[model samples]
Target chain A: MAVALAALIQDPAAPPARHIAVGAASPIPAAACWLVRKAGANVRLSLLHKRRGNPFTEGTRELFDLAGQGRIDLFFLGGGQIDGQANINLIGTGDWPGSKVRFPGSFGSAFMYMMVPRTILFREEHSPRVFVPRVDIVSAPGISAPGVYRRGTAQALVTGKCVFGFDPARARFRLVSVHPGETAASVRAATGFDYDEPATVEDTPDPSAEQLALLRGAVCDEMLETYPEFCRRVWQREAQERVA
Target chain B: MDLLQLDALASLVLDGATVALPPDNSLPSCALVRALIRAGRKNLHLIGVPVSGYASDLLIGAGCVASIETSGVTLGEAGAAPRFVAALAAGTITVLDATCPAMHTMLQAAEKGVPFMPLRGIIGSDILAHRPDWKVIDNPFAPEIDPIVLLPALRPGFALFHAEMADTHGNVYVGRRRELATIAHASNRVLVTVEQVVDFDLLDDERLAPGTIGGAYVDHVAIAQRGAWPIGLPGCYDFDAAHFAEYARMARTDAGFQAYLQRYVYSDAALAAAE
Candidate 1:
């Protein structure tokens, strides 16, 4: 998933991601950013959750200020529910303020999704409940009206099952690739929203041997401080330096 | 510095006052939250600088909060904040759902003493729909339709937080977490709790001046060593992850939450830590 996300992050079709900001609690996306950096791309990563050396010195709003000024090139977003039009619902299920089931309220998704030039939507869970026909609420519209001053929209939606390229013009997702063990039919069965797909959909390319080495070694080293549990779970590695 | 006892400082936060609090990483005063709960303060409105954390959940669990205006409230790594979810479910608290930048923009407006501030993005969000005070207007400078959301200024009744240190001159050094400075600047009264009180003026020192909130804005500074304990201060200590994990478990049920309150908040350790 990290490698697939990295490929999307470095996608030539999208705007160049010179500067990327990863939000708190996003381990997979953070890993992908690190993988992109370790692969020798001259990318600057502003990790909001970095405990020791947080990139934002002026406080949390500095990141937003930079994005508003068109400094940040890319960001990653996920939703409790994401619809066909790319509308994400981080606000809960039933009513306003999530009367039924409240996912943690939208952090900065309503702003970041519109301000950043490009965003990659990633949700590890890709069930029918998550990939709904329409989100209960729009935390941020996948596609805004022409005069809404939106900088960009979702470049692609990457789930555990497949990779979907988002076309803002049509405001629809086209299946780009399916992960191993997931066929187009299986993806169709799981998804709630309708999408486009080719005759012969290919499997998502596996991470190269070099990519795996970097992810398990250097990337894990960089991530140990912020994401020890992720490293331990995915790489089966323990933190060398005890943080607490 | 007009240093007061932790309880006395907490007392200044009267019932039904709106208070701004920073999240866990930014230095929330857990000690003060406990003090407020102990005092039985009611109907306190909480404005999470942008987002909320454990402190907000604790207050809600203790029945100290009437409403919360924040982007979201979570325990971060520990997962969902149980009490906050319970209160929301029970319709006990009014939730003014906001995006992070919207809250910051509102606070910035107050800091600048402006009526409102224009912020980009959020024009199409449902969060904008719920916020009746927020207005959308075309950018006057732009020839085309460039609608932007204008947030009303938010000047809270009190800005409360914990810091590493404060000088006798009342200047509190927040280190790099200048969001606390924004809170102090935007709020009506600034009440801070510090781990220690220093003799030297913080603003006089070049290294610290950039991070210090001037004493003129600070109404009271109380010495509460490890005041942000369990949540922890930025450089001073690490958050008690085990404790947090346990709290997340205990707070799932009302009975468990009350047990946690007796063992932690109302315990002797809380008073000793605050003193």
Candidate 2:
């Protein structure tokens, strides 16, 4: 129950006058939604609507507001595939033939990469397959700083095991930090291409008691409680099947 | 909350609707299914967009009372679920079409309670034969409209959603325009479970979730947190992988399901949790 997001802050006390946190908010939008709840100051979300193909339908305007004013400072995203330059391919890479892989689409990754001052990319699976060097496509550019991108694009990358930085100097992704149990080699094993600096990745801090409490107790209880019903149809159905 | 008490909730589905899930999932500890089961109902169905990780598969298996199915793929991207894939491979279950975009149309149609939907001609090549359930019905009423492909509706008698929070009477917080609401709206009745009740104005004073679901639509309102487990509850916790995997394995066989129910569900634990 350690503080999963404390490290997300740059200056906890005198936080940057401006910043943004764009949450993926998928699988269960609530996962990223919870993170935004903690980092509320400069955060925006790319919410999936009740209907697909109807973009910007639900809260599209709010997203426009957050990015429109450069209110968001950081972007956090996670999916199945990520390549060097931080191009992500959540769409299929291996299984599909000419059709290729399919993702939830880029969602607001394209916009966030341009609008947010800093962006961080993370992967749930820190394996070699998911961590590619060059992505199949650019969901969002990692080092899209000036001339390269429309300027003002991604700044950093984070994963379950480590952290990475975008070196505007070299115009590429560079390993910045690693979590406690991870190693540079293991981290690289998951990544696809070569980033700039191989030597200087640091370690992410452990989750704090306060962070854990906030994560568990501070959520909106009304909605949080109903999740079991979701599983009842999925997990419990099978649980009962195994019994009778 | 203690997860062991979850089966109390699982025992509620109509008899045939019970789908023994894979062993690799968590068994919820609540009353959602308890109410469903006691009614001795069946004809369970599932159709929604997609969840990020394992929630969709988990729900497709457990939440469904009669048959386990969905409209989209969640194998990281667009594709059939492993259960569906393997079922198609072994011929345990009949797979209609492996296309996702087309299925999205079907889900949209079903959600809208429509007879058929016009697709993007994706079925012209390979998927038409794959899906025996779908039919190309011509529209005599409108000659301009492409001969329509009608996918049957997957209408679950009820849809259950877990939200960020809900007012005591049950208007879901629209933190995002979510697929859950669509599923609920598409179905006959909705059951809404939330994290907890704020003073209503105590949070979302502007009514962030104002029109998401009317109080009348939601049959019941539950207040709980860490409610979306094995499914992932945002910052609260990552998915419970071990539990999820365990459920997946146990549910691989029909006999295994009976054994599961006799052990965990029929016990006093389920009865107590229900109480």
In order, the interface RMSDs are: 1.1, 12.3
Interface RMSD of 1: 1.1
Candidate 2, residues B189-266, lDDT tens digits: the string is 555545666556323455564435555555655654555544443434555545555545665564654454444445
TM-score against native, each model: 0.98, 0.44
Question: Residue B215 lDDT in model 1?
Answer: 93
lDDT of 1 by residue, B1-275 (tens): 69999999999999999999998778899999999999999999999989999999999999999999999899877889899999989989988899999899999999999999999999789988898899998899998878888889999999999999999999999988989999999999999999999988889999999999999999998988878989767778987877988999999999999999998899887666666
DockQ of predicted candidate 1 = 0.80
Pairs that collide, model 1: none
Model 2 / residue A147 / CA error / Å: 16
